[model samples]
Target: MANIFNIMDFLWAPWRSKYVADSSKSKREEKCIFCEFPEQNDDERNLIVYRSKYAYIILNRFPYNPSHVMIVPYRHISSVELLEDNEAQDIFRLIKITLAAIRKVYSPDGFNIGINIGRTAGAGIEAHVHVHIVPRWNGDANFMPVLSNTKVLPEDLETTYVKLKKAIEDIINNEDSLDH
Candidate 1:
């Protein structure tokens, strides 16, 4: 048998401490990744796949699954309940558009749409509330991704981004032609 342990890896683990905690200080220093889109010129950096009146759809950089994305309001609001009626409506509308776009591109079997309210509720950036749209597939469940530090992304991020971006743009351009 061969040894599978390494002490050198742990030596650099402490450097990641800043990202391992929930603090107002970190939030203040790092602008919300979701809120940086309007200023982001590169679609690759922004990962914006779709745009709506009051919100936009962006792929999750660290995704729970392939084609995972987040729908966020233009305004940075921490609580979902605080969203205006129009904003709330737009969120769902954007979600629908994003779902269809993903299905048309990736053809996932199902999806998981949700919003983690607070830090304790699994919100990485508790300063902003965004709805997560995670595509699901049968037999996609496996512990290796977690246990082995291996992620099975069938396609690269750039390829997914370009394909999704084009599909979403087509829907927006041919809005009347699109069915809901």
Candidate 2:
């Protein structure tokens, strides 16, 4: 008998499809997941690694690489220029911390931190402004992404979450210990 359903046949990502579709809804989708997630106070469930004054860090649900995270301003704004003084400061601070966390966890060779302003610019949630901190290793952008248009994350999101969460805890709890 032949294996009729091969792994290459499809990508099992219904949640991603739904999440993207939900982001496009006009009803605001229950006050925005970003706005609602922090209030929930469930770091593990929400995949939030750390929370600061005006911004927080959460692991990308559909990550391009391991330990890929986002620095999101609490207030929902699409444009980076509109970020408040405090939000901007906190977001930058968090980005620094995110880099450390990723280094402590994944130790990627490089990084790609950016923001996509609008839906046209590759923002899945264009209504919210968030900074992406994507870790990059040697040859990470390999055959799969280029040929199949699919990214193959070596580990699960939850595993990455746990690893990064520990790194965040180390940084936050022992701020003085880490190199400044």
Candidate 3:
């Protein structure tokens, strides 16, 4: 009980300050990042991996894991129910391809595919709906989170993005050839 209540024992994450600062700035000036990001053509700057007819895949700016990504529809809607049937279908398709690309690139032991519907449900940006695909391993949760509350990314975000982007390209090429 003493260690639990000790201030020194509490985990500290300084990197999150930037995210909080960015969130505040976005609230003041920018529109929904999910909406604005797709509009931008620079996938590298925007962290976008692939764009589909109705949805797109982007690497998480703040990732829980190295290759963490989000599958988002082009249209902005708070409630997932607002999505058109085609949008819903495309989202799932995007997720499937994303998983394959991620598997090829990172070869994660498992994944967490989910959507946080509301602010209370852990949606940092709740105005637009998006699905998160978090990769996991056998012993990823280690001393860092338990002791210091910091995530140790084995590889950089851009590096993972490049690798996954190539994997997606290969998959897309294969699929296109098969379609003919």
Supply the global lDDT for candidate 2.
Answer: 0.83
TM-score of 3: 0.85
Model 3 accuracy (lDDT, Cα) = 0.84
Tens digit of per-residue lDDT, candidate 3, span 32-137? 9888877777889999999999989999988888889999988988878999999998998788788888888888899999999886887777778999999999
Candidate 1, position 79, lDDT: 92
Off-target runs (Cα >4 Å) in candidate 2 are 1-22, 25-31, 146-149, 177-179
lDDT per prediction? 0.79, 0.83, 0.84
Candidates ranked by TM-score: 3, 2, 1
List the lowest-lDDT window of 10 residues for candidate 2: 11-20
Q: How far is candidate 3 from the true structure (C-alpha RMSD, Å)?
A: 3.5
lDDT, candidate 1, residue 135? Answer: 94
**Clashing residue pairs in candidate 1 (N, C-alpha, C atoms within 3 angstroms):** none
How far in Å is the alpha carbon of 131 misplaced in model 3? 0.4
Clash count of each predicted structure = 0, 0, 0
Best by lDDT: 3
CA displacement after TM-score superposition, residue 103 of candidate 3 (Å): 1.1
Best by TM-score: 3
- Give per-residue CA lDDT, model 2, range 76-110, as digits (tens): 88799999898998898788778888888778899
1-180: candidate 1 lDDT, tens digit per residue = 855666544423332244446345658687776677766756577788766789888888767688888989989999999999999999987877788789889899999899989888877888888999999999887655545656677887788899888888877777675564
